[model samples]
Target chain A: MTWQPELDELRAREAEARKLGGADKIARQHAGGRLTVRERIEGVVDPGSFHEVGAIAGQAEYAPDGTLKRLTPSNCVMGRAQVDGRPVVVVGDDFTVRGGSADATIREKPIMAERMAHDLRLPIIRIIEGSGGGGSVKTIETTGRANLPGGVGGTQLYHYTGANLSVVPVVGLGLGSVAGLGAARLAASHYSVMTKETSAMFVAGPPVVKRLGEDLTKQELGGWEIQTKAGAVDHAVESEAEAFDCARRFLSYLPASVHALPPVTTPTDDPARREEKLFTHIPRDRRRVYQMRPIINAVVDQGSFFEMGRMFGRSIITGLARLNGKPVALMASDPFFYGGSWTADACAKIIRFVDLAETFHLPVVYLQDCPGFMVGLAAEKAATIRLGVRAMAAVNQTTVPWCTMIIRNAFGVAGVVHQPANRYSPRYAWLSARWGSLPLEGGIEAAYAADMAEAEDPAAKLAEIEERLNRLRSPFRTAEAFWVEEIIDPRDTRRLLCEFADLAWPLLTPAPSGLRMRP
Target chain B: MAESPITIRAEIGASVWKILATPGAAVGEEEPILILESMKMEIPVVAPHDGVVVEILVAEGQQVEEGQAVATFRR
Candidate 1:
């Protein structure tokens, strides 16, 4: 009369599900230098904090007497887990189970994970691998039907997957050969990472691609090097443990969802501290390039800057950092690349980054040194100006509090778009700052071309004109006319930036940014 | 481990301004191998690792395209 026998049977089924694809398949997975889905979940989340939702929802074979004979668990292992003690919906592809193909999947489980993240207002972290519930040719034989795409999950799965972008922070990690839906899932995220040795992401794997006349290995087809360099993924890590650490660190700055402001940590570094190097960081000779990262590190909370999309956009650097323990979006110019002129790829990066900032309600701080949109035929072919205008629109439309520090060059339309017009945005400039429609070196030749051509000594006239403009070009003259904002000593940058962060903290709201984010 | 020859390429199209490292010269990671002038700014092309420069493929005042090999080294 006791229900203990049924309880025992339930426990047995749960244990059977935990075995994943069994010992031999799991061994093969291990031999490939990749962790199983369960191991990945354990490595990423708090120890023993995983609360699984569906442990035994899979195909089960029945005995002749109506007793359960075998249970093959679903390939999608999803549950709620604590990352840095914050609850998140973690969905991982169990690649050991039939390469995590559609034949081995229970689509509802992944759909439920997405719904949980969206409804609960929690972050979603996808530990992606294999085909990510995408179909296999064997599925046609198994079902005896060629199923239409988006039919199995009823489109709600795709809806929630895309909807989660505006509602919560989504992080995708490519831990192995992620194809089809897995690639889409990885690309559609606030942040994404892939392992250098183990991960490859593409719409399809090599076998299908080979029929298109391109024979290549998975690594050659869609390796981390190819994706990260192309900006298809944000980061490429050396190991799974490093990827987990990156995920934890990235989440540490943001709130659980867009319904909350970013988490503020207790300040460890002194806000008033100023580095002496800032004074001499920019060379007096404006033609020489300098490292912008060191300046960023010195101004933000020490070691808090997390850079993204480093390989794709060489001119503009985008990242997140803390100012006096308050998280903020950071944009700076890397003068080493095209003299910090915005390229087509850099412009695209800007749009995505500004959208992320607006979505999360994080205030933005730009260290400006833009010369202009890139020129030359390559730039035209890539539609740099068109993308640049879109970048300008993205910046102009943001409602977040903004602060701009003109460290050096700020010329042309690209330079003027540093902050939105008709807003109470605070702008600071260093003594070395320079701003104009164009630099004197290039402007004089263009503007005074007729005057120079008419002169007996054109070269001398050009130099004389340049010298006269150069004398008037001192940033003090601009400050005197109030054309530029306050020009302060470089050593005071961190102090002023910290003050801006303190001011911006109160202005941030937990409401969603009404505009749709472009992933 | 045996050192292999690694080619360092120009990241942007620019005229070579200064050759900072010569063949057989030892350099550290991120140490400038040369400087290229573009858009009125001097951009540095740096060593990929601690290595000895095997050759300088581009000369001063020469215009090099992006992705063109500028130097080679063995780490």
Candidate 2:
């Protein structure tokens, strides 16, 4: 006899799972200016490439005749999908179902998705909303008890969430009100993004936090502005569509996993291209500040620079770009903020970026222009020097090839980290480069105080000392002493960098370092 | 008023060196509205979007704390 009746039942349940959270709940989701989980997956991955798992795993109700009446699908919609034709795991929370709370969750589904990414060595993208199966007080009522902090399989959830970082690339997108475990998922990613208009992330949301006597709106509490400025999230976009675009672009610069080299695309921009503006880009006046972003855009492959955490670390710019079709990490100093000094926040930003580059085996190109570590009481309170030491250690321990160009000011201990010690790496200095333990203008008064005080005309004596020191400050003097490396014309920057990229590509090996990525 | 005006804040503690835009002046995105002097360098404060300057709360040579409102604008 044929088993066509059972086959028909299976098809019917799969169709029921496709109707996520019913029509009324989905309308409410749309009314709040957010998309459903299935829609989000479709927007982020390649068209018609999603293969959903556990489609029929959910609560089922049966009638008195021993036949199924209806099925309510699980809130976690997870599956394998392709991004730019590369396989990846996508796990999104269905906010239309029980507000994506733990009460309606099948806990094994999300854990299984993370396990799949870990075993298969594929990138995992988390589209977080609501709590992402985190704790809900309603769960206590449903089970008739209050359990411990970690749910039945929650430790495994956290384990795979963290272990996947060392093995493969992990990205997270905060698309709506996300709390607790959802917030942790977003924070524990190689790159994370949030929409400015529709996303808010926090450990606990407003209602619970209101008991602490702070009556604040969701936007005021943990909006895009607060999270991005606090360095909890990397980017904030204007819309969900833009957020998806960012995820796609970020993956383009990285490989599917640490076991493989980043894929190289055909070069559209000429490797020998050089801009004449670089020759006069740095202002003649030492006190003036010039834009650094344009200089970065001019040197790398055209329109390939992707900057991250722009709001948090205002002084240092960290991003990824391609040179001669090979991926490389780019770091530069912005003179507009504290004269490009290393603040505590900037140090933390650099540490994370350096770790990412080292883990992925991407060569680093640092455009040096640091004045020093930030000075004064605020700097001390923020522990700038402690973080600076940590940054130095991070740079010193990196095994990837490094190339540095001294574009402008380089002074003090912060400037000494242009390249790691005990390593022979390529380094270049421009005609405008000036470096020392301290800048000459303010340093003269501190060093020759006695000489000026003893002179009959102190002003003239000071001027004489300054003139003599200025002549010795020329970069060629350092070049003659062999203290600095080769000095080159600014117009030759791109050509020389492209040559370095050619040399660097052969040095990158895909063998795993056995070191876990620090989140 | 179709939308609320956006207030531009001083990002660092500095004295206003120059005010480039006047009240009711039309400015393009990223055009410098004023300059601030700090850390022996002149830093520019630019418009967040293409907008008209509606008000100047701080004048040239005035000392401004970080996060102080320096100007207001409408898109």
RMSD of each predicted structure: 1.6, 2.1
Question: Cα deviation in Å at residue A450, candidate 2?
Answer: 2.6
Range of the 10 consecutive residues with the lowest summed lDDT in candidate 1 chain A: A152-161
In the order shown, the candidates' DockQ scores are 0.86, 0.72
Off by over 4 Å in 1: B61-65
Please, what are the lDDT tens digits per residue for candidate 2 over residues A1-519?
Answer: 999999999999999888889999999999989999999999999999999999899999999998888889999989999999999999999998888876676989999999999888889999999886445887787788986767565688889878788888899999999898889889999999999989999999889989998898899999999999889999999988888898988888888888988888898889999799999999999888998999999999999999988988788999999998889989999998888889999999999888888888889999988998887778899999999999998888888889999999899989998887758889999878999998776788899999988999988988999999999989999999999969999888888888888899999999665557877
Q: What is candidate 2's lDDT per residue for B1-75, written digit by digit as tens?
A: 436889999987788999999999999999999999877788999999899999999989998987899999999
Local distance difference test, each candidate: 0.90, 0.89
lDDT of 1 by residue, A313-432 (tens): 889999999999999999999999999999999999999999999999899999999998888788999999899999999999899999999989898999988998659899999888
- TM-score against truth, every candidate: 0.97, 0.95
